[model samples]
Target: MEGDGPGGTGPVHVPFGYIVASEKWRGSQLAQGMQGKIKLVFEDDLTSDFYLSNRSCILYVTEADLVAGNGYRKRLVRIRNSSNLQGIVVVEKTQMSEQYFPALQKFTVLDLGMVLLPVTSQMEASCLIVQLVQEQSKEPSKNPFLKKKRALLPLESCLLRTVQQIPGVGKVKAPLLLQKFPSIQQLSNASIPELAQVVGQAVAQQIHTFFTWSG
Candidate 1:
């Protein structure tokens, strides 16, 4: 784990791997090429440093190895976002190690934003992360890469809006469903079981019932 410092300059010698954090895992499970030594800034005022998303790291790790209550047995291990780190990895077995401890209770886990670094023990390279974060906060990014925006569908036949026309969907659930499952054509072909997995069983049943009756 790194020290509590702004800009990089925290813990050094992050190991080759460790367990994955749940928050980092959730938002990044489907995304690819989001790994390696990219600079991480603490999103908002939460943690002091951010590294690569933990979920991305977990792709290389196994869930079974991540037992609850166990801290890094060694000093050079990478910190991750998980129930154990967040006080949620409940202990179901008593025979586990006595050293098993709960995670540091904190809000806003760090987000991994870049991937260009190899694990190193160099202090200067570690400081570079802090410098990058500090520099970023001082100047608005001029990089064209940072200025890109999400593309939206034209309003005329916007499938999202058309789905909103469904009865009982209303303002909230309609957009929620669209955001959850982006394509309307995908929604049309989605099995009730699949939709239920995205939404809840009850909501999925309602959506399937409505679409089946109407279409």
Candidate 2:
């Protein structure tokens, strides 16, 4: 997803975790408050107000903007159509603006498939944005909330697989052997006759030979 502009085709270039704020948004209450928490870069060509990364940006709607009309929707629509940036809307949700938020949420989240975050004031919004930028800067693996692609295998399945790796073991014999011996160390310590109680004598002898074989 390209952010700020169409030409950001490769990697996200967030050097030292800078939040690219729109020139129009510069020196605003949000920008001023964020100065102490993050690095802010002012630019004129961004479709959104703040670019968190090359692929993610934020669009801020103040209480005045919400009460004004659906004007912010046009900006949001432009961002949705122009670039594939992850748009996060930080809207003022005070008593004056709360009535408009439901409709705004529908347009941004339900319609545009963007993230909508509500803050009571510019100060709170600034704090929230700082946390977002900080979290985004960290490697994805370090964030516990993010879903992982590959879930760990269950312990029973792992143990079953380990048992089946022996010389003369299969799915059928592995579970039975594990039920009796439980661990690799315990299984290796079993005498041939003791192993034969679970698996047959031939397989038990083979198992003993596999564990004792120094080759």
The candidate maximizing TM-score is 2
Query: What lDDT would candidate 2 get against the real structure?
Result: 0.69
Please give, for residues 1-215, the per-residue lDDT of candidate 2 as tens digits: 23555233333345557887778878788889998789987766556787776656778999999999998988888766654455567789999888887787667644664456678889998887887777665554422312223211122333455467566898888878866875555777799999998898999999898666643
TM-scores of all candidate predictions against the true structure: 0.26, 0.60
Worst 10 residues of 2 by lDDT: 145-154
Residue range 109-159, candidate 1, lDDT tens digits:
111111112112223333433333233234443333223232111111123
State residue 150's C-alpha deviation in candidate 1, in Å: 12
In angstroms, give how far residue 172 of model 1 lies from its true place.
Answer: 1.7
Minimum summed lDDT over a 10-residue window in model 1 is located at 105-114
